[model samples]
Target: MPLTFEDLLARARALPRLGHRALLGIAGSPGAGKSTLAEQLVRTLNGEGEPWVAHVPMDGFHLADVELDRLGRRDRKGAPDTFDAAGYAALLRRLREERDEGGEVVYAPGFERVLEQPLAGAIAVPPTARLVVTEGNYLLLDTGAWSRVRAQLDEVWFCAPDEDERVRRLVARHEEFGKSHQEAVAWVLRSDERNARLVAATRERADLVVRDLVGWPDRHGRPRTGGEPGPVGTDTGC
Candidate 1:
């Protein structure tokens, strides 16, 4: 049986503080609400008086438009190969080691959707942050560049939603990002679906599996209980 969102939160909060830092990876299919859940967790934890939480997204490591063009992978922009996975892993390692010594700001890269380029130093993870919540599509991917990422995290949570809902959200997301409805549907069926299948297979590796009930509480803000809610709608660019 899968745990509810609240169960996942409690599990994360219970992690022992490491001398270095804590890295929490939230992974899921393309439209399975991983980014939304991650953001909600950070916000909720901060609001509840945990101020040391920060976010470092994998999408931030996507290659620049020119590089993608050179590699001829622009059309398949969200594919695993489209990102600089090794660089991302290196940054995670650095984050675990670099304390707040000398007030040096740890600059991390970020991907720009509208501009379709990766900008270095777009995000800075301060040393004061004790909990880093990183979310993406390939965190648990077992092959290639993604394999290194899983080993760097203290814990990993996999989000699972109904397939119909996931597809609906993906289509909506694509359309919201300026794709035509037809194009969005096609992309969801062609690219996003493929990625989702790959992601779904990694659930067994997660420390916890979260099933977003339809009417469940706004697990981030207040407390309520019911069927799982519709998938969380958020555009964290992952």
Candidate 2:
């Protein structure tokens, strides 16, 4: 029998049992369904009863366009250097070490899709949250400040779907987010592909490699604006 989404849910549900609070990291190349899987896990696991799971995306650490301009890295916005890796690592550390002493809330930054900027204190993790699901492209990366990220997570899972499907999803994602089809395709091949290759090299470092998640929506399904397209594909190439 194959491992279904229910099996994945069971794994996620058991995470908090390992400690006071557990952070689950989902890493993947562009359009590999990292965000979508994380979202579903949080939703289904919390649906059982009172919500104890939280979703905190690493996209919030993206450097604003202005900073990218100053740094002359605007061309490679999705590259690892275009983000505040150190800041993200620190936030993960805080999330792991800090407990709700007396109804304390740990706020996290969020990414504004339309504006393509990071919004501070956009997400609130209340005292009730025991599991935090964070998805990003570089969680397993061992370079620079990114090296600190994996240490903060209880376990990290890498999403590896088919290459062609991943590229198609990346194209569609850019189009839905305001880019012209041609521009989206060009960006995917030029920029996103480069970043994707870097992320793929880090796959072996993950605790689990999720190939295909059974029952996930197909790519042709109604698309999400700021998140990954539905999981569609058979080949497991990250």
All candidates: CA RMSD (Å): 4.7, 4.0
Q: Encode model 1's per-residue lDDT on 34-121: one tens digit a residue.
A: 7777877777777777487788888899887788899998878888998999998998888877665554568888767667577888
Best by lDDT: 2
Model 2 Cα lDDT, one tens digit per residue, 193-235: 9999999999888877787444554333343442334333323
TM-score per candidate: 0.86, 0.90
* After superposition, candidate 1 runs with Cα above 4 Å error: 1-4, 16-18, 100-103, 215-238
Give the residue spans of candidate 2 off by over 4 A: 100-103, 217-238
Candidate 1: C-alpha lDDT: 0.76
Could you tell me the TM-score of candidate 1? 0.86
Look at candidate 2 and give me any clashing residue pairs.
Answer: none
The collision pairs in model 1 are 213-227, 213-228, 213-229, 214-227, 214-228, 214-229, 215-227, 215-228
Candidate lDDT scores, in order, read: 0.76, 0.84
